[model samples]
Target: MTIEVYAMLKDYFEKQFIIKEQITDINSLKEYLSEQKPEATGILRSCRFAVDDEFVSDTYQLKENDSISIIPPSSGG
Candidate 1:
C-alpha cells in the first residue's frame, strides 16, 4: 500500500514512500517505519499519526490510498 507520510520537518525523512508489505494498522506502520529508518525511531515514537486528516490511534485500521501524516509536537516561542 502507498501511504503518504508528511513530516513537519524535512530532516525527519525522505517525505514519502510506498510499502510493499501489508500494513493493517498504525502500529504495524510504525514498526515498519522504525525498521526502515532507525534514526527516526525516537522522534517517530513521539509523533502523532493521522489518516485522511483525522487524528488516529495505533489501533486505527489503515487502507490502501489512505493519506497519512506524521505530526510532531509544535510550540511557539
Candidate 2:
C-alpha cells in the first residue's frame, strides 16, 4: 500500500519533504510515522485524513495502491 503524504504534514514529521510509503493499514502507518518521525505524536488528533481525495478517518481501512494525505488545521482570511 503506497500512501502519498502531503508536505503540509512536515511539521509533524520533522520538516522532511512529503513522500510516499508502503504500509499495511492505518495502524501500521501510524506506527511507521511514530518510528520514522517521533514529532508526529498527537499531530493526528486534529488532522484530516484523506484517501484518494475522499475524507477518511484513521480507522479507515486502506487498500493496496491507496493514496493517503494528512492535512493539519489551517486558518485563512
What does the lDDT read for residue 2 in candidate 2?
A: 38
Candidate 1 on 1-77: residue-level lDDT in tens? 65555545347566676777778999998888888778778877888888878899999998977888877777789
Question: Would you list the C-alpha lDDT of every candidate in the order shown?
Answer: 0.77, 0.65
Q: Candidate 1 local accuracy as lDDT?
A: 0.77
lDDT of 2 at 61: 79
Clash counts for the predictions, in order: 0, 0
Candidate 2 displacement at residue 41 in angstroms = 1.6
Query: Best candidate per lDDT, number?
Result: 1
Candidate 2's C-alpha lDDT? 0.65
Error of 1 at 65 (Å): 1.7
Q: For candidate 2, which ten residues in a row score worst on lDDT?
A: 11-20
